[model samples]
Target: MAKDFSDGIKLSQPRPYLTRMMLFLALVGFLLLILAPRIMDAFLANPGLNGLIVGTLFIGMLYAFRQVLQLGPEVKWVNAFRRADPGLALPPAPQLLAPMATMLGNRKGRMTLSAGSMRAMLDSIGSRLDEQREISRYMIGLLIFLGLLGTFWGLLITVSSVGDTLQSLNVEATDSASVFTSLREGLQAPLRGMGTAFSSSLFGLTGSLILGFLDLQAGQAQNRFYNELEEWLSTVTNVIDVPATAGENTTPEQASLLALAGQIAALTEQLHAEQRLVRELAENQAAIRPALEELAGSLKKRGS
Candidate 1:
């Protein structure tokens, strides 16, 4: 039985960036399990600040993962289009690759493969990538900021308590036992203050380190996706598309797409015009051959 391409090629499964993310997270979890006792003690020492840092770190990780996930559709869109059969419907393209869906041209009510001058396309992709990464970058900065805030806050508490303890101490007391008892009670407050300082610092710094690594993973994924798109564009040649007419009921998105297609069509015309000019110049040179030969003959006879 022969299968018809009336239906477009089946799209390949989207590649995932979660594998490395999951593996790295698992490793962190294992390490945390081993240090559970120490971590529990620190959390107890300053529950308020430590809990905040941990919560923010979790949110940032989720955001980073989502950014990487969004990149998957773009790669999938490009790959499917590259392999798609002409006049057959393939899966829908992501927003970033929407230009390709139109730029390829819709012929006889079906898609046809066409690619040319990837610079504009690449630039568009890069700008979208920048927009997506912006939030993740801000989250990273926020994590670091929170860590620093906790450190200074804890230090302030320690400093204030130590100053109060010093002021309350008596140099000379009528009864030595009473003086020692009062001194011990005041010293306890300073010790607890020191605990708050060290515990908050520990959790804040650890949370930042973990989030930083996840951010690095996200960056590498984006770079790889961009490079793949660039390489695919290199091997393609141009096709001049006829921009579709927009109807009164057309949505803003569709209108924008039509405009982009029109721009590309204009550029293609310019390229073809330049090609025609070069061909004309070559033909003119060919036409002058006989005249050039006669001129040379006349000059030779005169010289002789």
Candidate 2:
């Protein structure tokens, strides 16, 4: 009459979770688009409102997309693992030790494989980093395009208004009242056009600046990670032959044990470093949380 513990909880697949999140975001974006006109109108009614709205939306969208990109590989890895063995009780995927072993045994292969793997790793990292940069660049370009579109629309309005003023002046025979009215209409068009041009340009520039800053920060973080990974790989690849056991030929068991021991030592070092980093991060969070909360409270009070 033992109860099965597995029935109460069902595990969700990574792919579905990712898809759901992406879909949810898309839906939200669509909703935002639908309300954009009203939102724009509201902003137009208030001073500095457009800046806040545009900045917040651009930053939020960039952050969300960046998060998706960051999580994408993890999701893929998880889905790969799930698809690899359906039983869910399968052993973890084996590491490709053959290449490492071949490299260790053959000096030439060792050099070749080491160099190749290092190059491949570097290239992969560089490609991903480049993709991030490209995305940021494209976003900047899009912003600029939108700004130009706004400028064109504004210019069109200005031109139409000027034409109407001219026609009215011609028809009204140079009366002072007609001139003033026509002039006012002409001014309205240019004024509206200028506002559109300036607002769009401001949003575009602000988006580019914010995204550029975020991209730089992300690049720095990624580079730091890459450096750490490279160091770890270098350490791993520097494995040397351990002295053979006394009075016996070097058996496979002994060699494997030595290699494993070396690997364990390396892993231990890495774990210690990671643990220290985590501890420092936790400590920093602990220290910063209070200050952050206080700042938030002060801002809230001011806003209220």
Candidate 3:
């Protein structure tokens, strides 16, 4: 059933900007992962940590690319729905929005599409829209955590080396030259450890920034698609009060509908006028009440 509808309805190509942005992010991420090791000697020494950071970045980038692909079908669905006839018809709807069309089909009474039904349709699509956002958020957090983890791991190495060197130094057995050599070797280890710490931090921060931007762009695109869909649905889909019957006298029914509509409109105007009069009376009540009370007292006194 899904295949049949998909074959019938034309799908638009992915937006160029989205495609280009994904490509740009992929290329840059690839370059960074490749060059980081050669450019920074520390990465070469700690290949495992650097690899993990780069790997995490690639995962985030791929997820963003997948989100862009999902949005393409949505764009096509919105465009088709916008161009479809306002009356009840098999409008071009995406798989995600197929429930809406189905809901309309199941209607049997004089009930038109109500605001509640519209809300339900939008809520159905909202889940799909939120999926990418949720994934992006997780990726962004994970990338940052990995970076921080690397930084702390490098710091731990530095601390451990310092402790080992201090424990190895002997005061009684080593001469001045020997002690000096021990100190020099100990200091060198810490410097190397510091380099690893800084290298991991640098890569981690860069990865997080890239993922953040991609996530932001994806969110914007999703929002735009949703707004367009909502506007189109609002304008094209209507709340049909009267249900059209098959092979029956529609003339009397239509005339009755028109009469009912006219009556409702007249009643609405009448209600508004009555409400205005009530408001005016309420506003003047404070001033008028005292005068009316005074007149009543005067009339009583005159009677007495």
Candidate 4:
């Protein structure tokens, strides 16, 4: 796979799995989360904690978007295959597709397509896809955990402060001015605690919702890509077996010939499936030539 840099941005197919509506809503929500805290200072008493959660959410979103872009090449590869473009160049190979490309390329055009091999290939692709998406799942869980932590921490501080204020109460003091002042000062701690509690929960829950939705979108994109790849493979793959003529009656001398016949039959089926597949056979000619030469030598020895 080749990387393209027409501009500063790398060119890739299936750009940004997120839709325009999703992007707009997420941007608006983020802006509100950032700005609302400053405007409603009373509600968001602990700006520092809120800021940390917001920053973490931003990092998670960015990471998800990056993964979305990385998945582009796999989608593109499936599209190219479906279009029957043997000459089409690929973009930078994605993790899910890298092993597949390596397998095909290593075959030197003499590719094998057995049911077991196909299952293994699909399993490898699925594993890579799971690994790629695992981070988003962790990020969602982290956001929720942060929210709960903030909520409980704030409540504990509030409860402790209220208890201390009750213990320090000078209710029997004669000075009314001193009493009022002490009461007002005592209330401040609880108010601050309330602010911390509400603000953290707001940001944490909001961030979790936003990221969860985005994760769903990314998962859908991945599933679509996987489906397309499966479809493409189904169309191109051909499995041939030794014919009845080469059954129990076939002599040992004919074994090599039967193998050659089976290979040709498979290739013929491949050509029927996609005209462009024939062009690809040219690259495999050298790879297959040695096998053919060996078979021919065996035939001559038997005849002699």
Highest lDDT scorer = 1
lDDT of 1 by residue, 155-237 (tens): 78778877887788786878888888988888777677667777777776777787778777887788777786665554453
Give one clash count per candidate, in the order shown: 0, 0, 0, 0
Error of 2 at 17 (Å): 26
lDDT scores of the candidates, listed in order: 0.73, 0.55, 0.72, 0.71
lDDT of 2 by residue, 172-217 (tens): 4658787677677667766766676666665656555555555555
Writing each residue's lDDT as its tens digit, candidate 4 over 85-179 gives 34345564556677777655433232345555667778899888788789989999988888888888789889988988888889999999998
lDDT per residue (tens digit) for residues 1-304 in model 3? 0111112333345586486676877788689689865646856646788788879888987788777777786676555643444454644566666776667554433324455676788888888779758988887888778778877888988999899888988867648999988888888887777877887887788888888888877777777667765654554345555665643537877878878989999999999999999999998998799999999999999999
Worst 10 residues of 1 by lDDT: 1-10
* Model 4 worst lDDT run, 10 consecutive residues: 1-10
Query: How many clashes does the backbone of model 1 have?
Result: 0
Write down the RMSD of all candidates, one decimal each. Answer: 17.3, 27.0, 12.8, 22.6
Candidate 1 local lDDT, residue 187: 76
Candidate 2, lDDT over the whole model? 0.55
CA deviation > 4 Å runs, candidate 2: 1-60, 63-113, 171-175, 239-304
The superposed Cα distance between candidate 3 and the true structure at residue 29, in angstroms, equals 5.8
- At residue 260, candidate 3 shows an lDDT of 90
In the predicted model 2, the residue pairs found to clash are none
